[model samples]
Target: MIGRLNHVAIAVPDLNSAMAMYRETLGADVAEPFDQPEHGVTVVFITLPNTKIELIHPLGDDSPINNFLAKNPDGGIHHMCYEVGDIIAARDQLIANGARVLGNGEPKIGAHGKPVLFLHPKDFNGTLIELEQV
Candidate 1:
């Protein structure tokens, strides 16, 4: 069951500049940056009462986030992640509803080490939807 608003992912070309803007201009308290070697992203997190705001940049050549940023280049919402109590159930629902999972199966570790899985944008009215269980 999806539970909460996990976070909104924003892919930017420059991580430092994005973090600075979110902290200085938006008055959001930036958290310690971390690298998800698997996804090839270095991310900074900003916690809100419900959902968090994630600023992400590529850390390597094969970075998924890098490809996303390159394609979009707007540094806007990359995906909307909703916290789920049961990722399996949530994914099942999508599958039954004719949605395809981005990967083979199971949720993978996303930013902040949260377990997450993505529904293909093609299946979700062109919106990349993520379900995460923290």
Candidate 2:
């Protein structure tokens, strides 16, 4: 089952501008950009009192963010991540409940260095859901 809200991921065409908007304009605490070549994204985390905001940009032409950005040039919310106590158990439960997992239905190392799995957007009311082990 899902736990606390981990973070909300936003796809951005420009990582620098997005980081500045959050850090300088909104007066938020932004972390340095981290490249995730395996995930094909470069991410910047904006920490908050309760949760974090993830700014994601394409790392290469084949990055999934590229497709997302192509769909919406202005970029938008890409996914919402929720914490889970046991990722494998949660995954099995979701599968048993007729939910589809993205990719090969296995957990991958996320930006936080935690095991994470993505669920199909259609299964979650058109919003992509990410389950990260806490």
Candidate 3:
């Protein structure tokens, strides 16, 4: 089952501008930009008291974020991540419940270096859901 809210991911067309808006304008603590070539994104986290905000930008033309940005030029919330005690168990539960997992239905290393899996957006009220193992 899902645990605490891990982070809310936002797709952004411009990483630098988004980072500045959170760091300078909002006076938030922003982490350094991390390039995730495997995920095809360059991401930065805006640390907060309770949870974190993830700013994601396309790393290449083939990046999924690029397609998202193309659909919404201003960008928008891409996904919401929730923590889980056991990723495999959670995945099985979701599958048993008829929830579809994205990709090959396997966990991948996320930005926090934790195992993560993405669920189909339609299965979760049109919002992409990411389950990360705590």
Model 3, 13-63: lDDT tens per residue? 888899989999999999999899999999999989999999999997789
lDDT of 2 by residue, 85-128 (tens): 99999999999999999999989999888999999999889999
Misplaced by over 4 Å in model 2 are: none
Better candidate number, 1 or 3, judged by lDDT:
3
Q: Tell me how candidate 1 scores on lDDT.
A: 0.82
Candidate 3: worst-modelled 10 consecutive residues by lDDT = 60-69
TM-score of each: 0.90, 0.97, 0.97
Error of 1 at 55 (Å): 0.6
- Candidate 3 Cα misplacement greater than 4 A, ranges: none
Q: What local distance difference test score does each model get?
A: 0.82, 0.94, 0.94
* lDDT, residue 107, model 2: 95
Per-residue lDDT for 117 in model 2? Answer: 95
Tens digit of per-residue lDDT, candidate 1, span 31-91: 9789878888888889887678888888889988767777788676788888887788888
